[model samples]
Target: MIGNIFLFIFATGALILLNKFLAAWLPKRNPKEKYLSKAETLVFIIFLLIIAVTIESYDVNSSVSVFTIGIMVPRQGKTHRTLIQRLSYPIHEFVLPVYFGYMGFRFSITALTKRYYIGLVIIVILALAGKLIGVICACMYLKIPKKYWLFLPTILSVKGHVGVLLLDANYSKKKWWTTTIHDMMLASLVVTTLVSGVLASFLLKAREKDFAPQKTCLESHDTHEELRVLSCVYGVRHARGTISLISALSGCHGASKPFAALLMHLVPLPKKRKSSELLYHELGDDVHGDDEFGTNDGLEINDSIDSFAKDSKLLIQQVKLVTKMLNMHVEICNATEDLRISIVFLPFHKHQRIDGKTTNDGEIFRQMNRNVLRHAPCSVGIFVDRNITGFQQPHGFDSVQHVAALFFGGPDDREALALCRWLANNTLIHLTIIHFVSEDSQTESPVRNTTTQDNNDVFIEVAGRDQTEHEADRSFLEEFHNRFVTTGQVGFMEKRVSDGPHTLTILREIGEMYSLFVVGKSRGDSPMTVRMKDWEECPELGTVGDFLASSLDVNASVLVVQRQRHSHDNFLDD
Candidate 1:
């Protein structure tokens, strides 16, 4: 029996190791990742079959080898990892249900007698209390916030699939425990898991009110104060463009109070069973050497900090080289709530591939953007890089960097103009404000016309008022032009493109002339925007910004800005 058990263990271990070796080898052996992913999937299935055979032949009581082999498989790259996740979706959705259902069938409810009921209640209470107490104690020792005390305990108490597997293993071994005790434990597992899930849901709903501050941060910000901006970059490739935008917004051109920039490097969490601490420790000896601005508070510390620490160590070395040359005071850290900043800058997910076709990194980046937008403490800007290699001059230099700002009159446009106002301070940057006035703004609607003279007088008065409002808009633009458009510093250009096709043509022509394009996100009932809406591929880039960023002929990097929604009341005055 002992020899058979050893043989089973040896065979399964060998197959798992072989599977890992092949997975690593196949990718190198084949250039096409699609073919390699298929080959890796086949190898995984073969190892699982071999483990099953070993278990049957040796008459092993547990199927723990299945779980062990899964953990043993190495994730090679994003393509390989994504393929594995896609392949396992069916098993997780369909097969797990059958397996768990079969386990449920073996559970005998009749075994729960009065005597066993007492033990079952005791087991459930103890399981809940023990798990909750242990996690709460750990959280307290770590100085975690009190708001998360109940939430962490509730989530940690969830037994989930592992609990089912353990119970099934015990039930398979008939003599492992007495029948009544085994049945009671299984019932307790079900009860505690359900209770924990309910508690977690309740805690999450109750915590929603605490997030109110995120909405208020932008509204309360004073534009006259030193601008505090938090810029988030996913990789080193995006660092240059993000820093450029920050430099432009920072008013880095000999300003008395320059912008304070906090560079937040974002990274996806590591795969399952991987220790983030180990990853950080292996990064280098000088991991925490430059983290002067980062805090040691345990409340904000989590697994993400390890990734942040690792990425920050790498990013600081690169960012410092640029920030130092620019003479900017920049702090590098992970994107977290510990630091409060007014504006957050994020890079667009899509990147131009070797074949010239654009591809996004993955849904992870898109989801990250959505989360930031949903809960960001202030205004956010998503920068789409078109690899504009034309304007490589250092920001605030005397060399001309032409910037085009698209304005159509909305809160977003106002915000974009405000940002340009800051950029206009630099003597090197020549700013062009392209004001697009749609045909709808010039014409009054006939829908409200009436035959009565009194009604006609009222309608005429309203039409006159509408014309006066249009004049006010023009007056505002004139004031803007008078303020910025001095001799050779700023230029104001107006385009009266009525239809969408005409607007696109005008934008295409204007886009070719500029090194950078800044545009608002909202269209504000503009007829030109309505006409161009059909051509919008990515609405997240807004209309004009998307057209410029996606157009091959544009040749300009785009900055799409959206003002915080709650700040419209305060910002409209500007």
Candidate 2:
């Protein structure tokens, strides 16, 4: 009996050592290959098992002999580890239920007598107390997050499959484990497992939103302050294009209060992991890339970003997070609040192909974008790329990059113009301000804040303006024109449109002329976009953004800007 007990302890030590050794091999996998097949994983486990069986004493279970091998594998890069976790998740789901069910079937709960029940109660109390004390000690020893302390004890106390497998393996061989003893062990196992699961569920649910409060928004933000932007992205396909947009935003006329961004590249998380061993996110690296199925261009995405940052005046913090896709928005919102972000830049749900045809990437991604829009604490911009991964400069007398802001007079429009104010700082960037107004519009100072009355960029004088409603619009637009246009750094123009169709026509005609087009996500009750909603496909993009993003042949990319609107909504619950 003493030898048997010693073997159990000895085998456990071996398991730990092997797991550590094997875990170190994780980095050997491709950095871009974030997934592993169940078949492949199973073979790896089997290989470890065989090696462990060869090394360990026959008295200990083979599972126990190779245990440390599970923990000792090669250390993986953040992306590699995250990939395996996500890839191995479904296999865990399938195997866990099957394993647990088989164990449950071996138990005979109804056969226990009053005497056995009394003993069972004692066993359970001892088990709970022992695990709880051990966990409390570990918590004090290791600086684990205090929040996880609420559930880790119970989670660790939950009975595992290995013990049951051992009991069954030596069912008739062990003289100590009589039928009566076996029944009681299985019964106690079920009790502890059920209790642990319930407690963990309750605890985790309560702790889900323990994140800090989010209060910043772009509307009230200071223009002179360095913009703290939380830009969320997925995959490496659009990384360069996203960086290009960030480059444009980094320039300012003065000492340049450029954006200091926390660029988050999100990936799906694994289902199960050791709380102490897991890292939810880590700083992304500047790796190289190639176009292969398992090894894709994702590796090179950060290299481009690194190169860009090295040469540019922008401050960028790259982070990669591994989390559930459904609950990703919660993480984004938390990061926004933690970093006090002023704005969040999101990619459009639909991506434009080389042929100018647009296709919806994924409904899940779209839902995540909506959730972010609903819960984000700051201003948001949905960037729609139309072959603008490289925002090609027009070859002309200008021979420079042209940026256009289509203003329809609203809080969002004002924000778009505010961004344009910074774009004007880049002498290579020629800024054009296009105001879409109705026939009943008036301006006291229409003495042309604009220059070079060219075709399409003409100033139109109108009549019968709404003084009360357009008060803010007129004030902001006039200020923008006076400051930028009067400095001879910007071109200002006004176009009178009868309806949404006419406005859209005018926009499409001049869309490709500029390298980038900026527009407000809302039309601000303007009659110009009243009917545009009838054809609006992506409401998250707003009417104008939807028009440009969904169009089959618009070469210029669009940035749909939305200023934060104050409302009494829950952080994420509402």
Candidate 3:
């Protein structure tokens, strides 16, 4: 029976991996990803029907066996498959918590009166210590940012359900005071969860208060969404936590500020920045560079700055919507070394778009940054306020194993690789660099027509060129492999050149195979264009990056490194 159960577990695990692979790799006929493909959906439905049939045919114990087997059946497609995604969450969240709580319930009060008391105390200490150790090791091992190192551990430490499940699976058959042990374990689990969650809440609240002043000069006032948005743009974890805290605080009805702080403790920090460069270009400008920032020659304007400013102004002009909202004065400025603008945020600002001619606050900021980047004769860093790290330990990866970096012989790309090198060590991430050469159009060439319609076919048609591209990819693989040979990484390297119409699109399509995107922050007069090769169209700033972040959708983030951190005393830095 035990062997059968083990077999069942293995089969179910394999099927789950297969399902995930198909979900990620299959081409989507519908671009929106609104519903699972028709064929997959049908298979999923059949899977459900088989489970239902098996349940009807078997008794409770037999049904358990059947259900275990049913999990192994392929269910690749189904309508609203993501809707089913929520179910696993409950198993992870609520059921798992209950499982752990039940384990705590297994402990006996009488055990404390016996020789077991000292051992139990040691056990409890060891458990907590183990989790903390894991967190610390992850941080030091991954070299995570100082701020993230705080909260990452607390959130990672909440092992309620899964831990309980594992304990039960392993100890269910034990007869040595088994029932008592189970109850005590269950009860302790409950206590641990409540206590840990509370601790997390308080830590986050304190961190927010600390960072609020640093985020923007608006320490005197309470307008924070703009700052939150900016942090989101930076892909900093602290920024994400601040946004959650601000959103939660703003929506709370009767909670005292202290209580609000307590609740803020439990939230996880943001993993990635908002990632839409276009929005910053658009809305950030409007807020900072209104008529106050005069545009000189060759200065491009963004739309977000104006949007943020205008929206903020409107919130103030129409105070009824946010009468209960806190109004603080936060100072905002572009830290670009070139043309720039700075603005003081008041509680209320107007947000109006009139025939494409309406002016607002964020738009002003966007325009100001653009003016600076184009003609300021220097770089810019927009500083809003200053706040920093949470109190909990950060969650870090085991070892930076298997890292991949994208390089295009540009400074930004080189800078990105340099950053990776700084982060690398023996036990850290294994790095792979891909440098692809795109074919330039042959000028005034006599064309030969071919019947092949597929793009992959075109690449194959060029025999010598195909060999050249493959050799380039292989050479990269050999170089990295040789470099890491002594580090117990038997091998490390992979590369490919995509002659696709859009670099960003190709990046997105194939990016999921890697852990993170390490592309350069494109700027200046570099020949590296954001233009989609297929259409010869320049996408808005941050378009490809944002879409890629959204599509990958799971534990993936993009890092946009500033060549140098711009000096700006206005925004917060903590």
Candidate 4:
């Protein structure tokens, strides 16, 4: 009996460490990997079924005693044991406690009237106090968020299993001292578990009220620079990923159709060649071919042979060149290193038509799955002028005010900077360009803010504290003062550095507050297509985009911009 008691006590201590490890491991598993095999599931279900039937059989004492025997069921093999171990936790954490607590509540007062009473009270108090101290230690170590503190005590409060185990000992013991100790311990376990559960639940609710809110700053000002906007510039491989406010106003008009058409228009087409008579421009001249093709090198390329075999590679290269000539941002990369190519391409296949033309939305969305979803960047968004959804356009501010511009080095970021430039130079909108510098960049691309004399309005924040950190990584935070907190010119333009949750988080937080969430369309489908493709490479965004899309809390209006290609009268007609 003494050995059995000692073993149970040691086992409970081991369970504490095991439970902590399980808690950390469970949250990280992929959904498919989180569960046990079908065979294990079946075994657990069968055990649970038997336990349920036994508990309801009205033989309460025997039913409770059977738990020990039940856990010792014949293991089919190591795999079966592993599965049983995985499945046991759910029953141990939830099912077993409730039954034990209820059973404890039914303890007889008459049976406790003898020598067992004092020992039971003492055990109960010690168990409860020990659990409380453990919980407090956990709280301190975890820095448990105030809103969640009430929940902490409940996690520690469970004492029913120990109480049930004590019951078996009480029955086996014949001596007064041994029986009394068993009864007292059993009683204490019951009282401590119940009291702990209630107190923990209440405290958790209290902590939740004090939960710290995430903080971000947003600012906006009146500007006269007309918002240069484009929607769904890049091609989206999958049209289904888009969520356009325009889609909402359109009254459930399939988002994919318009979204696909919007993307095709965004794909930068190859530049067209004009007849030889056009005047030469100094910029973008073909320096490499000047000696081979004479003065009018472009004029000698009319032969059938040149057109037939036509080094398909050269044509493609020329097409790419022309596309860049059209001012489309084109980046050539080693396709082998990054097997995934993330581009905001037309979401609809070329065959589908929209607006009296074919559309590509359906084909892209339906075919998308985990393997291909990350292989190619696939998010789609449609931009329409008239509210497809009931979104109202913002009216220009006639009162004239201040503006702040965020400087990040992407298309949308540059556009935001351009908007600020336009506002500062051309309109009533007072503009300040705020660039966040990291400690590493401070020594390299250091913006001598000393150039500005306007101390009241102009501001720059260096987000990084240490000098050794990567310049690209640092975010600027104003350390001592909320200088721009009340300033009217202070504005925040949401800039997505890469495809990730931070973009969504920044978008949701600043989306409604800013006059616009300045985002650059792929110039290539929907704004999200390029963004999502970029996200595929990032571990954080790939995990979070699905959840954020379903969340009710996010708020923001997306403004996508496509850079206009510079064209002249000499351009090809097609």
Q: Per-model C-alpha lDDT, please? A: 0.61, 0.67, 0.37, 0.34
Judging by TM-score, tell me the better candidate of 1 and 3.
1
TM-score to true structure, per model: 0.47, 0.56, 0.33, 0.31
TM-score, model 3 to reference: 0.33
Q: Please list the residue runs of candidate 3 whose C-alpha ends up more than 4 Å from where it truly belongs after superposition.
A: 1-6, 21-33, 37-117, 144-155, 170-172, 194-574
lDDT of 1 by residue, 396-508 (tens): 35556788888776666666776777677765677887766554343532213232432112211111224554554455555566667634467665556556688788877
Ranking of models by TM-score: 2, 1, 3, 4
User: Highest lDDT among the candidates is held by which one?
Assistant: 2
Error of 3 at 223 (Å): 32
Candidate 2 vs candidate 3: which has greater lDDT? 2
Q: Candidate 2 lDDT, tens digit per residue, 1-574?
A: 5876576567566655655444434424643444344554565557665655554445445554444444445333332344355546765788777877876777777778888999998887787788888898899797655776767888876756665665555446678878788889878777877888888778867775653323354434455666777677776656666776776666632345646867787765546643544343431232222122213444465545645654664446767766787889888877777787777888877776676567888898889888887777777788886654326423233657788898777778878787677677666678888887675544454434534655544444333435653576667777777777888889877777777788888878886677788888876556677688888888988888888776644677888888765332468456
The TM-score that candidate 2 achieves is 0.56
Local lDDT at 264 for model 2: 82
Candidate 4 overall Cα lDDT vs. reference? Answer: 0.34
Residue 229, model 1: lDDT of: 73
